[model samples]
Target: MNNILRAKNLGKVYRVGKIDIHAVRGVNLDVEKGEFVSIVGPSGCGKSTLLHLMGGMAKPTTGKVFIEGTDLSMISDGERAKIRRDKIGFVFQRFNLFSALNSQQNLEIAMQICHNGNIDHQRIKEIMKLVGLENKLQHKPLELSMGEQQRVAIARALVNNPLLILADEPTGNLDSANSYKVLYLLKDLNRNLGQTIVLITHNQEASKIADRKIEMKDGMIISLS
Candidate 1:
């Protein structure tokens, strides 16, 4: 299978006055095209950091990341930003939606931003329908339940038709029922749309939806299954 993402000797360090904290250490990961992988770990385990590195959101202190064979560390910030904008989508633990905007408007705004004003109403409708939010197009984030809000966020993430989706604890804010729904939606996306996904979560059940599960501890990967 073709590698959609790869990390070689990836590491990140943060210096606080007198000490250097290793947020990630010699970590390596690869995600195949159209494959769904989950990274599971406790808080402070560096799983989120690894996600950021892979998505070109942060520079690695030492090591390299290749996304679709482009070396992230070797690119200029503007170039990397272009790659991220065109190829990667992100879902965070919090639904970072504009509280005032309706669901459809939220997605439309994302589409404009992602495509530099080339709004695709047809594609937006398709994505909203895919995420089961076609009926709630006029509902604002505050008007919707947490699950609905997350689904809107997911729809916005898909607005640009990105090649990879990096989700960091996307179900963390929801209840068990809602979390199950969200996880199932992610799995369905992979199964139906061939969407490549890398989800970071502490929930074992949530992680199980992925094709492979990687466990991390204290800044290093401890297991892959």
Candidate 2:
């Protein structure tokens, strides 16, 4: 299908005892295959909440999330988990790598969980090469720079060759130079490999790397360009 993801009137509401806090409201979105789209917004504007809903990490309180034409709200939690593992690759702001595991091992765990089958060593190597971390495969998180660690995280995400990648501020911990490099790497993956990506960021300059930019505020999308 041309659209890898679709959200229909999606909403998420948190019950804080006496009050209901609406995080996402009436969001309708379509993400085409191989498109690099970024969701940009200020803190507390519901960008992360929206991403969580899209990734199937959190179920929406209202409406539905359709991934590869499958309705998330209609499926069981286990089914949704399977879809998250097999179809969506998530890159978070924190590297989230195991402290003791080397870059290669970190990726191996992800592959093991998602593939639920034989590990593909060649695929792992290719993804490491793609992220320019072939040499650092044996190094643990402490041995690598923040940018390299993030690169390892990215490589881990790509190892599965998923239908879509959801990166949530993957460069948030880096310096300007590292952020620039990471952003371009994502851009290159999208351009050369036709990797579909949806990134969430509050940095306006960083959001420019995306093919499409979506702005959100007050629990809703304000603009998409």
Candidate 3:
């Protein structure tokens, strides 16, 4: 299979006052097409930083990242933004839904972002139904439970039919039951739809669902299995 995502010599450094902290250190990885990969570690181990770099949300201090053969570090900011909007869907730890908008409207906004204001209501309904949110389309974020809110967020991510989904602690805020629901939804997307996914999490259950598990510690990948 071709590589959907690749990072070579990836690194990130943060400067705080007089102190320089290395967040990632010369890490290298490749995610094959249709593969579901997990990055797991304790806090401050650079899992999130690595995810950001791979997703083109943050530039690496050194080396390169390529998404579907496009070198992210070589692209202009506008081009990178376009790639993110059209090719990548992100599910953040926070639901990040607009509290004022209903579930359908929230997904419509994402469609608009992806399609440059040509909202596709039919596609929105399709993705909502896929995520089991068709019944709650009119519910606002405040009206839904945490699990429902996360489902909406996942639906928003899927509305664009992105080639890659980057999830950062997607179930971090949910209880065990809700977390399992979210994880199973992701697994279903991979197993059934063949969606490429790179997930960052501290939850062992979340990581166990992945096809491969990579353990990171102190800014380096310690083991990959």
Candidate 4:
């Protein structure tokens, strides 16, 4: 299979007063197409930062990230933004849904921003059913439970048919039962829809659901198996 994402000698440093805080240091990673991979680490180990870099939301201080053989470092910001809009989807732990909009409206807004056509209501219905939110489409974020809101976020991420899904601490805000529900849904997307996913989380049990698990510490990937 082709490698959908690659990071070579990636590094990011933050200058705080006289001290340098190395968030990610000389890391290398490759994620294959249609693979479900998880990055697990303690807090402040740069897992989320790494996901941002991989998704083209942030530029690395050094090294390169390639998406489907295109060098991200060489691309213009607009080009990267286009790639992000069309090829990548993001689900955050906070379930970044708009408080003012209902679930279907939120997804429609995302489709508009991404310039996505084929906005079939039937497909939207299917996704809603897939995430177990068929009855909650007209509800606002505040009206739903945490799990339901997160599922809406997932539906919005899938609306564009993105090549890669980058989830950062997707279940962090949920209880154990809800966490498993979300994780199972993500794994189902990977297994059934063949979605390539790179998930960052601190939960070891959640990480174990991935096809491959990578452990990071002190700004470096310590192990992968």
Kindly report which residue pairs in candidate 2 clash with one another.
Answer: none
Cα lDDT listed for each candidate: 0.92, 0.93, 0.92, 0.93
Against the true structure, what is every candidate's RMSD? 1.1, 0.9, 0.9, 1.3
List the pairs of residues colliding in candidate 1. none
2 or 4, which is superior by TM-score?
2
- State the lDDT of candidate 4 residue by residue for 192-219, as single tens digits: 9999999999999899999999999999
Q: If both were scored by TM-score, which would come out higher, candidate 1 or candidate 2? A: 2
Where is model 3 more than 4 Å wrong at Cα?
none
CA shift of 111, model 1, Å: 1.5
| Model 4 deviation from the true structure expressed as Cα RMSD, one decimal place | 1.3
Worst 10 residues of 1 by lDDT: 109-118
lDDT comparing candidate 2 with the true structure:
0.93
The residue-level lDDT of candidate 3 at 85 comes to 91
Q: Looking at model 4, which ten-residue stretch has the lowest summed lDDT?
A: 115-124
